[model samples]
Target: MAYAIIETGGKQLKVEPGRFYDVELLHEEEDAAISIDQVLLVSDGSTVTVGRPLVEGAVVEATVMQHRRDKKIIVYKMQPKKKTRKKQGHRQELTRLMINSISVGGKALATA
Candidate 1:
């Protein structure tokens, strides 16, 4: 199997074609196409390519499946002696991305 490491939303992730991953929210509409060029490493089964900072001409293409929010979590705080209490709930915005292809030098090496 071929895989590549990409950086997005201030984090690095291992990505492959035909797989879906939930990443930090992207400002694109559902079914929109996006290309990520911050490839750090690519393993094409037989050879590996590591970039100095980012691989030149390397890109990972994906489609935005949906925009959703993560499961909510509760936060609670209490002041035992003062009889003060606080409670909060939070949810993180996320986007579901389906990897479509990985390419180098404008030639796709893997596809969904």
Candidate 2:
């Protein structure tokens, strides 16, 4: 079994093929193809490899499942006994990705 930790959008994620995750939105459309190449660490059951920043010749391939917005969040402010109130809402832009494969030196890793 193999797995890798990769960075994107200033965050690191443990990823493997066949799993899905929400990441920062890309300019591509739904069902589009994408690749990520910032692998930081990789482990293959018996051995573990860590990169200084990123492993050379390592990459992760993924597919864009869709573009969507996260659930809206409400922000509120109130002043006691002052009849002052404020409300706000926010939604985050997100891209849904289905991990296709993770490879080091162009070789796909076995499922973890």
Candidate 3:
């Protein structure tokens, strides 16, 4: 098994091939290919490579599966003595990604 740790949208994720993740929304459309360059670490069965910031020539390839919003969250504000109250709901935009491959040292490995 192999895995890569990638940074995206101010978050770190451990990615494996054929797995899907929900991340911050990007400008691209659905099914578009996405390349992420912020690779922090990669590991194979016998060896591991950790980058100072990010490994050179390391990239993660993924596909944008869909665009959607997360479940709604409610916000309420009230003043006990002023008869003031407010309510709101919010849903954050998100993008669904399917990890295709992760490459290190110009070589690709199977991730599971």
Candidate 4:
């Protein structure tokens, strides 16, 4: 199988064509095309390329599928004998992306 390691939203992901991924929030409308260039590694079943920091001319193309919030998480705090308590809930915003293709040196290497 062909895949690539891409960095985005302060995290790295192992991505393949035709797959969907939920990542940190992105400031873009749904269906917008995005290209990620911070590719750390790429493998085509037989060959593998590893970047020092990032691979030159490597890009991963994706489309924004949706924007949504993750599951809610609750935080509670209490102070013993102080009658102090706090409660909070949070839901992180996230973006859904559909990976389209992976390319290097302007040549397409893999596609969905």
Best model per TM-score = 4
Ranking by TM-score: 4, 1, 3, 2
Q: For candidate 3, write residues 26-106 as lDDT tens digits.
A: 889888998899999988767888999998888888999999999999999999999999999999999999999888867
TM values, all candidates: 0.93, 0.88, 0.90, 0.96
lDDT value for candidate 3? Answer: 0.89
- Model 2: number of backbone collisions: 0
TM-score between model 1 and native: 0.93
Q: Compared with the true structure, what per-residue lDDT tens digits does model 1 show for residues 1-112?
A: 8899999888899999999999999999999999999999988889999999999999999999999999999999999999899999999999999999999999998999
Please, what are the lDDT tens digits per residue for candidate 2 over residues 1-112?
Answer: 6788999878899987888999877788888888888989988768888999899988888899988999999999999999999999999999888988878898877532
Cα lDDT of all candidates, in order? 0.95, 0.85, 0.89, 0.96
Candidate 2: 10-residue stretch with minimal lDDT: 103-112
lDDT of 4 at 110: 94
Tens-place lDDT per residue, model 4, 3-111, is 9999989999999999999999999999999999999999888999999989889999999999999999999999999999999999999999999999989988899
Better of 1 and 2 by lDDT: 1
Candidate 4 clashing pairs, residues 3+ apart or interchain:
none
List ranges where model 3 is wrong by over 4 Å: none
Model 2 segments more than 4 A misplaced: none
Model 4 whole-model lDDT (C-alpha atoms):
0.96
Please say which candidate is ahead in TM-score: 2 or 3.
3
